[model samples]
Target: MTQKKSPQGGTFKKFIVVMVIILIIALGFTGLNYYLKYFGPNVTGKQEYLYIHTGASFNDVFKTIKDEGIVKDSTTFYWSAQNMNYVNRVKPGRYHLHEGMSNRKLINMLASGTQEPVTLSFHDLRQKEQFAGFVAKKIEPDSASIIHLLDSAAYLQQYGFTPDNVYTMFLPNSYQLYWNTTPEKFFKRMYANYEKFWTPARKAKAAAINLDPIKVSILASLVDAEALHDDEMPTIAGLYLNRLNKGMKLESDPTVIFAENDFTIHRVLTRYLSINSPYNTYLHTGLPPGPIMMPSVNAVNAVLDYQKNDYIYMCAKEDFSGYHNFATNIADHLANAHKYQQALNERNIKR
Candidate 1:
């Protein structure tokens, strides 16, 4: 014996079931929205880069991201960053952004302080200040700060270098490093590389030639300045070595130009040679006090493996080619110099 339901009660039961279904759908929709907002991709555009400067606040980081239009939704990104505690962990560096990166991914990267390394390379740097300035352009530290460290005598003495010869510590090459490296770290890294470059074989070769590493670098710089072509570096190195062995003045034109502090002088004059600077090889009978320019690795090696020859003098060829004519005697050298001088006169290079 079953009892029949009333119309009003049945309608009430139907209304209750409808309300429950509506609530379930609403809950599911809200959960999906939350998931999409937090875990889904919120960044927009093709690949891009972002630079977060040191000491930048969270607001600055957000503003930079917003201005660059890197995110698809700002509110979602802000919420995610706050929730992940990235707002307090902003790191300074250069970062590469990929297309369609999620906010979570981006925030994690910023929070971790992971940065792409900067490609740092320097060559033919004429002065310490110039090298510092060049490095400053690529890193966080200013040129003055780097120059200050380089000029510190006590600081350099710790590294077996004087303020004058510290320039030799940096080898000319491309290096990968973080953009925020400090001055001290930069010098230490360069010195480490320099040490690695002076292998046992190279040291032994230097010893055989009676030249220390510093002296070899000094002579290498002269060879580097004189050789316009890589193929001729060995011969130039040999000629200078001969001059050093025979107790003759190096009389390098580059040294005279260096002593005069005039790189613009294409032709070294007798007046420039009289400069009293220790760098004037015309007056000094041996290597200059320090390198005139950053010697390339090839130049450094050329001195270690200098060609065996009796030549004691070299002058630029009269044909205006980059090659030089070698001479073993004073008479032949004078003739070569005369021919070069005549060619210079014809070209009216009268500096």
Candidate 2:
């Protein structure tokens, strides 16, 4: 009779204990899901890919890559890549990183032996020989072979480039391409880019100015190096245009400086200014043999947009803020020169 009076409260207590056990199990599973998605590293292993890029953040790379009908899961990728120290491994260039690349897989791809490549950057290149040399250094091309091709008219004609014609083939812009791109293919791409930029409209405008496109590009290179201000581009372009029209020497100090290649000149002495190098516009009456540097598109365009005027002489003002004095007569030019010289003296700038 007393056993029958067992409290219903005990039964409720038993149910409560079971429920607590179930909740703990469910919570454990949830926590594991979170850890795998966010905390686990090395999610992918041994997957090959075409490429990754330098400066690409952990998130950006995962977003761009495509897989077989399913992209890599971003949540898993970021955590895994980060944990495996895959940051800062992206290089520039076109790559064919293989499928299912692990963190180790990707890191190995960026190693020196990795076939993946970054974009090609030309650093302050001045001559065709320099470009050829850079190509040789970066790629597997023999320097002698490329140099021979550069010097050979017949060989270059296949690439639509004439011998000694640096202006028609390469533009000073970065190109992203496959690492294994052949030299012939590289030049083809470079030439195509060159043609695409120098449209017929540009050619006709160049002719209308009575300036040879090649020669104007040569002068534009010089003006680009000399003019510090974007606004000064056309004015400097026009100054050279005027000098060319009036049959006067360019008399650009930058040209003389480039010829000297050393900034140690206490001053541009009459002798140094009169140096006989082809780049010395003070020596020759016109533009140099070719561009002194790969010119920007703006500088090249300025040669076509050169304003017509009687200004045959120009000199930078003492302020050095990119403004210049334009002079049509020798007296005004001399006076401007005197003022600039005085400023130089006061500032104690060695020439």
Candidate 3:
């Protein structure tokens, strides 16, 4: 239908159409971004500190980004992150992050976590003091920083070392943490594992024996020090358990060495027995001040589930294979000890 039209009205109508097209394109981009933030797979990005830490929330993550000056408007960022679909994929612990990453980029990085690395392990630590030293070497961390943080005096002992809480720590399994983990965080992670390991069932078993798990660990450490093989560990543990139940002295040479701080075990004199230290099992009546060394789990488990037998004493014969002779009475033990001493004198070569 032909109709009369003004030139100005015609130009304005064309301009309105162009404005509508531009608005449609802008809305499409916004919707696409929303989809990407929520439903996009394999979200990934690089980060500097490489960790998220414990007790951190989504808001904390958003704040970290804001404080880094990666985003200009925090309100917009917080709202976007809150509305994102993939936000639940964020994990706890350390993560690698990138500088100046957009909200879209950060979400992807968390969802696709190829960034977290395994934290290093502390191996063969004997005492709490050694654990601190171990952290410095294993983590290449500032030793001075963690030294005072993990005092064995606080963590390992209360009444004495024998009554200490060494078993409070759990053995390591597969765990995901940042490589540059701090000493406090490392202790917390380890303590958490420790608590998990001491389940109620295990605690009940320890109570049945009238032995604190930590005390059992103390004995386990002695067995660990005495044994050269894992096979004889249970028998060794059984001997200690039997002795404890009988109200007899342990008289272990390792306890003596623990008191002396000297590692040489080849030679022992009557004077050594007279060494004035509570750790000397020969002089004292019970288990020495906690674990003399960081015993293996096998050693600890062996002590926890020791065989209930009549044997009250154990002494290794000429063989250094860690096997021991078990006896029901002190007379039998003295005889075995005599034989063991003769064998020891015959093969007196120090390595």
Which model scores highest in TM-score? 1
TM-score of each: 0.92, 0.64, 0.62
lDDT of each: 0.89, 0.68, 0.67
> Which scores higher on TM-score, 1 or 2?
1
lDDT sort, best first? 1, 2, 3
- The digit string of per-residue lDDT tens for model 1 on 212-250 reads 888899889999999999889999999898888889999
lDDT of 2 at 51: 40
TM-score, structure 1 vs. true: 0.92
Per-residue alpha-carbon lDDT of candidate 3 for residues 1-351, written as tens digits (9 for 90 to 100): 898889999999999999999999999998987664444432233335534544567767766766665445555556666666545766554455555556666665665655556656644466666666655554424677675554456643432332244432535345555655676676677767767777888788778888877777778888888787787788888878777877889888778877887776665566788889978889899887667777777787778787667777777764666677778887998898888787777887441
lDDT of 2 by residue, 1-351 (tens): 355645788888888999999999889998976665544343333344444444556455555553421225655555555765665555544445545544445444543335655477774466667778887666555567667767788877776556645643566677776655666777778778877987889889988878656666777787787777767888889888888887888888877877887645545757787677988888898777666677776788888887666788887787767688999999999999888888888888766
Ten-residue segment with the worst summed lDDT in candidate 2? Answer: 42-51
TM-score computed on alpha carbons, candidate 3: 0.62
Candidate 1 segments exceeding 4 Å error:
1-4, 11-15, 45-47
Q: For candidate 3, what's the RMSD?
A: 7.7
Model 2 ranges with Cα > 4 A deviation: 1-117, 129-148, 151-154, 157-168, 263-267
